[model samples]
Target: MANVIDTLFSASISRHVICVFLFISLVYTQNTVVFQPPFVTATGPTVTAFLLGNTSDVSLSLRTVSPSNTTGSIGSPSCTDEATRWVLTKEQIGKTAVRIKLRLNQSLHFCGENETSTNCCTKLLCVLEALQVTACVGNTPKASLLVQATINARLFPASAGNDNKTVIPNQVYQPLGPCPCDLTVRVCDIRCCCDKDCASEDLKLFASHCLPGPFGGQVSPDPDYQCSVQTSKNSPDWFPFLCVTSPPENNPYLGLFYHGSTITPKSGPSFQRQIVSAPLPVNMYVQGSPIITLNNQYFSIPQRVLGRCVNGAPVAFLENFQVECVTLLRSCPTGSPLQTLPADLSLKVMSGQGGNVVVHVTDKVVTDLNSFISKNNALSSAAQKLLCENVTLALDYKFFWQGNGITAVTLTRTIGTLISNVSVSLTTRYSAVFLNGNITAEPNSGNPGYQVGKPVIAGTMDNESESIQRAFISIWNPVGDGLCSTAEKKVVLFGKNSTSGCLLPVGQQTPPQCNLLRETVTNLQASLITSTYVAKRGNPDLLNLTDWMNISFVTLNSSTAMEDTASTCSGIPSHQHILVWSLVTGLVEGVPQREIRDLQIRYTLSTWAQDCGGGNSLCEDIQLFPITSSVTFIDIPVITEPPKARFQINFTEYDCNRNDVCWPELAFPITRYYTGEPYSQSLAKGMILVFCFITASILGTPWRQIRQVWHSIAL
Candidate 1:
């Protein structure tokens, strides 16, 4: 009997402790409240609305319920406590923004009857308030404005320590705990979310900045959210982050326009506390299509806008530029002489850079924005007025700078379509190393950026001499490999070749992108490569000084087809004439700039036997033997000298900086190599190696160590 009484006392004590714990959570745990646009459907926006409630109290009984849009009517509001769900209705998302409030009630279970059940305001514990959002409401995108960019939680990656809690991932990310484990931030399928489809119709297209969002949002921990929920299981380093391959193109006819920041122009010229943001506060990200307006007409540059990281820095660029010419008709009146305007559009790459965004060219086309309107006058007047009434943006404009800076106002118009369409190819240098101290680290996995040369490229932002092989084109000329007269030339094949059927090499399997290019360059007989050249950070002293001057600029476009061809592979038959053509053409920069000369066929083989067909007709008896290599470029300014195998460009400091002192090929003494060498490569190499060793021994660079040093420095 005494033991039974003790047990009863213990049970009563446990019940009291439980009630106290629940009370503490109800009273002390703070609540976070916010509003979101309802998911609209064909019928209407779904009533399932969320009132995000985040607290450390961990009381599972709390829920947001009884949602009421004061000015509107909602289907009897209902909720599930576990998920903080509140059912709203289509009527609640009316034209006028509604003021909605949700009751955060903690289910009461009276341990004792007198525990304050007096105030029955549905026992109003707290409120989750929200304002109606108008955007992201329609089931179909009625406007041309599609998704510009969609970012995710990886921006604020979780850690073994305090897994992404404070900032980084925005507040909206925490609403639905569907994320598997905060390992990656899933980019919501905007197409499904906003009913916008920018791809070829009939083919349900879903795309994303994340490698697999279109496939289905990364697998959700919440079974309710169906999709391929990615986890660390796919790849240890795979972290779902924000990315966009090609954002939906805005109305091409509307022309490119900048929705400038909304600001009241120094109201009445009165003193006001400064509100400024620089280096953009957050890791700056701006994405737009390649359509530029000229003379109030939108001309779509036959190019796709894309973002890629080079050396861990983001670069916005355009590629495969297709040219289209059309006359934009002006309408002053019903038949006001059919005022037609001819215009051209071209691609421009703007890298998110620090320091200052300056352009060195004096003659570059400039569009001043000091007194400017947002959209083209060609757009409907009603839309124009609507945009104007939306924001009275303060106007600020200036000339392009001679260095990298995005702070000043830029009109960002388009280049006119010239008769030849030969005036365009721009380069933007991107390096995470430059942003080391200046910008916050924005993580990207698809393009982890080139993994080498950060230390070499860091401090020389202004000096063109400091630039190295940041771009690559894996090119090759096949002699009659009799691969059926087929040649493979691709920078990085994004599409398939109809004739060859093979997807052409993209080299997704190589490390050190330079080598990846070098190893994947399709060869005629044997793969070609350039000799490794050494470069010190900020100085170019190791290679032959003359080679540096005559071909140093060429080094900007340095490339190698097949290296040491004489020693490696046998040449193609004399009858099969070697041909040189461009696989990748630079806009504005013609053949003269990228391909200075045709790469010679250096064919050699190891079999040591010329087992050719008897008459050399069908060649059935002889087995075809050709080795493939990887080169990073097709045709570019190059010096095919044995000791100096590198791609080069004609762009001298003159072209880059517009200075009289730096003329193209001015520093380089052109060396002409005629047909037929007198000596064997072995002898030439032996003598050159000995002489280099002796000279370098005295000059701090041993000829034997040059290769080793460059191997390390390239990183």
Candidate 2:
């Protein structure tokens, strides 16, 4: 117990020096002073230094100091000593003891290796001759470092050219940041797999340095940095995605990896490939003509033409004069023959009637004068006794008859007589009858002038020479005997006796000379009684006066009773009995006046005497005679012709899809959507479930725990 074990070794060396000063103050307040040669003076210094040893014994030294004006000159330098000789050098690697490693390619330097003097082999051969120098001259060598000790510190960004200067191992050196407000860490991607695979890819994988997140970790093998390679979501299916951020001085991990995927980009496909390459097609043509031209009438009969088609083809129009074919030949099929004409001819005549006759004859005996005694009893009694004994009648008579009846007869007569002279006086004797007469005193020679016995009046003493005597009686009379008399006493008379001769004066002796011969027979019987001789003897028996007293007593008793009866009946009277009794009484009286003159004849006659004897007649002696001969008729007139035909038309062109090859349907469908802003707020629905649960919890962690907590961060 050597003094009580010296108090237990002085209390265990003071509790082991208070547990080694509380483990060095808890590693100097949470082990964050890792500065292995880390140095950064303002902006430039020939050494950005750092080296915490392990990776093999720490030996990273970079030192550059120029800029001096006779202050502490090394190799005479100015111009601010090549602008403070930008520099960098780093080395800090430790595996257990709370791990820590960072070897920034040994560190950096310049300023001609600080005017060398074999200063660590001229600053490690001037950083290995600036890594085999390909091209680098000015300004890009700026340097910075602030690594303290214990652990947690990084500032990697070196490899520039010559095939990798080294610093990759899960790279991420995020630095540059300011310009344009840290423009995504000043246009990030400093190589090293474009800063850890395009910093979580997307944002069009940092699109060829149009930068933002392929930050400074310096590991460029290019292939656009293959961090397990994955980029192409088909390039966002075709363009458009941009995100850029960062600032307050740098590494905001490229503004948190491209600000949430470029605030919603993706969307492309060239507007649906330009709407399927621009579109167009649909057609029709038809101009005019399915046949037309009428009047010259080719109506082409189809019921009278009407067909149609317009925008396709085929058309016609003519109707009714005869030729129809309406609407694609409206079911045509009835005897077919489609039109024509010509044929009709004619002419005519016919007639009747033929009867009639008349003839009239008239004579009426022959007008007047007892019609020539009834046409002279038709004449031939030896022509009426040579026209009544040579035609001599007194008072100028005239009669005529010729042809057809009396055949011919004519008579005419005229005769004359008158004579006388007588005078005798007692105081003056006068006696006449000179040439054939007697003045009986020449013998009475005694004179009454000679004296006479007074009363004895010897007048018979014959001569009495009386101085007055005259005689002028030359009478030879035959006043009227122009006999046309049928009777009128067939006159028998004679008396021209100068005292006795040519006499037939009969009987009674004179006594005053028989009273002057009975006063000359009473004045010749009163001048032969005339009624125009009894109208020319128109027989009233000729107006007889006892036949004029029997013709004056038969010529004075035929010489005094035949000389005194010829001795008293002279032998008993026989003289052929008086001429046979007058020839039998004139043959029985001429057979009863010739049978009454042939019954008053009317024998008809008309010898065309020049056509009834008038002037200017011709034209076949115009008696015109046609009273009636013949004519008769009834209805009439006729002529005729017409009938013949044939004609055609058939045109067709129809097809609205009757298996006739498509094309004809468009009547109204075409609608397309999605343009940006997070797919248009993810197609609306209140931020699409809170941005799809924060992007599926950031891809469900474990990406090496966010790259070891972002490479133990201490920029």
Clashes of each: 58, 48
What are the C-alpha RMSDs, in order, of all predicted structures? 35.9, 94.9
Mind giving the per-residue lDDT tens digits that candidate 2 earns over 406-504? Answer: 011111122111111211110101111100001121111111011111110101111222112211111112213212121122111111111100121
Q: Estimate, for each residue in 642-696, the C-alpha lDDT of model 1 and write its tens digit.
A: 5633433544454535455644433222211221343355456557778998786
**How high is each candidate's TM-score?**
0.17, 0.10
The window of 10 residues in a row where model 1 has the poorest summed lDDT is 142-151
Location of the lowest summed lDDT over 10 successive residues in candidate 2:
344-353
lDDT of each: 0.25, 0.21
Error of 1 at 215 (Å): 23
Q: Residue 636: error of model 1 in Å?
A: 34
